[model samples]
Target: MRINLRGLNRTKKTLADGTVKIFWYAWKGGPPLSGQPGEPEFIASYNAAVARKVITPAGVLLSILQGFQASSDWDDLADRTRRDYVKLIKVIEKDFGDMPLSALADQRARGEFMEWRDKRAKSSRRQADYGWQVLARILSWAQGRGLIARNPCEKGGRLYRGTRADNVWTDDDEASFLARAPAHLHLPLLIGLWTGQRQGDILALTWMQYDGAHIRLRQSKTGRRVVIKVGAPLKAALDPVRQKEGQILLNSDGAAWTPDGFRSSWRKACAASGVVGVTFNDLRGTAVTRLALSGCEVPEIATITGHSMRDVNAILDAHYLHRDQRLGDSAITKLENRTKSPN
Candidate 1:
């Protein structure tokens, strides 16, 4: 029997482990309806939800959150970012949903929010910071609408201080990984190191984006179109496996890789190869490092990597250039040549 209920929102999400989980909500941004559809408890909950005069009371945190979700600001976020924010919003709703919106305006509310963040940081600092950021964004949006006198989440500093500045892969690490990893993983590794593109962008890359000499695509995050003159190494790796259509990078099954699936495989391959302390993301910075070492100027490197001029400079200065002995050696050689020149 097919069951249809008006005002019910059903969402299906696939877990990292490939399990399908179905969620039922009374309405968009409304309370979740418990139990499976067609069950007595589910029907009862649905009835009660619809009967209620108001799902969320005004001047409460939950109401503000719902408002924010409906706003143009929320709709403007990138698809992946919006999905991530939805998870954080659920956490915020569970923790502080019923609290009066007025409490957020109190100067002391910032301390309380920080305390909540501190408890979460004990388990995962990066996750805690992400949650704080999302909550702050929501409060800021609410403040703009004049629902709150102030945003208490402002200036809540990060708990995760980990840096990947020095985490670029070395030549030996690259060799070991390629030797151990499956053949399908090779192209992705090469593309990251060569093009300096993010994992997501590379995974989403299609055959159409590549010409014989150049690969062109607009970065999903920044919307910047980058036309990379395919490096010798990447081009060599790409040629034999080049397809007439579909995504460039695929898994062992010859299908496009999901973010989670690729991450899991990449981690196992790294562990098997004895590679540690670096990630696929570090390839971006490594590309910048390699470019600088090859005598490419900042603007030129930025053009290839799709990073802004300032970002390229910061990556070189704060992360790679100062620490690289080769750059230091080149600087000394330049000084010696200048000193030896005829006056």
Candidate 2:
């Protein structure tokens, strides 16, 4: 009599002593099936392996989180977003991993989650809000999968109310940073200011994306492709080191930069230059401000920065442009010129 099992994996290994041993498992990467072929113990082990319980207790939050992580929704998140979410996920697991999944069904769980967020907010409100968002997303995913009766994170409002309206980098900051920072750091600064790109996109920029006159790239987070005419300053910076291959910006060692590595170097440079109260990210809004000050309309700015009309208008109306004194100066100058002109 012969026996056949579905999803049974068998392997034969030759020992150093010239003996051969056979191994059996329920499936690839699954639990081992003990005993010999056609034996009751072997069949029983195989069945148990096939019906292996969830790694984390099914009633716990950790179990649903683990399931969410294995789903296609997690796989579909942008790389940068996933990196940010992973940090929050770790915090959630540490604090609430053992909480009962059923507790989420009760409205009281929302208060508990908000209390946890409140504690985190005391240290950094922005981080607390980000963590709360990630928790909400995870709970929503679990609920959609029928792993939970309800998502307690629903309707959880943001805790951070800070704005970047006046956060644009100034010309003095740029000049000081350039004068103090290393030569290798200069081009990245120029690229961020002139192109209005995120640090991630700028760091990932390769020579192939540039053509002396223009730069072409697809934003990592939004997946929007943009073609920008090279500004005079950025062109001047890029011309001398133009390469047919590899990244446009490199470290002192002439190698590509990882995000963490670039951020660390940038922080050191910023501190050394006395350029305080402004960040590299502020350069994006600064670029928009510069374009507006130069008399470019919202649509023109959108075309260059890959911002939608609404985003460009929002940045101009509610953020950087409104706070910039240069725009006021430009408006007065234009009015003076208009009055001076003969009718």
lDDT per residue as tens, model 1, 152-217: 998888899987767988999899989988888888899999999888788888887888799988
Clash totals in order: 0, 0
Top candidate, metric lDDT: 1
Residue 100, candidate 1: C-alpha displacement in angstroms: 1.3
Per-model root-mean-square deviation over C-alphas = 5.3, 10.9
Instruction: At residue 275, give the lDDT of candidate 1.
Output: 90
Cα lDDT tens digits, model 2, 28-92, are 54444568879999988777655653444558887666555545565455556766876777789
User: Relative to the true structure, how large is the alpha-carbon lDDT of every model?
Assistant: 0.83, 0.82
> Pairs clashing in candidate 2?
none
TM-score of 1: 0.84
- Judge candidate 2 at residue 225 and give its lDDT: 84
Off by over 4 Å in 1: 1-55
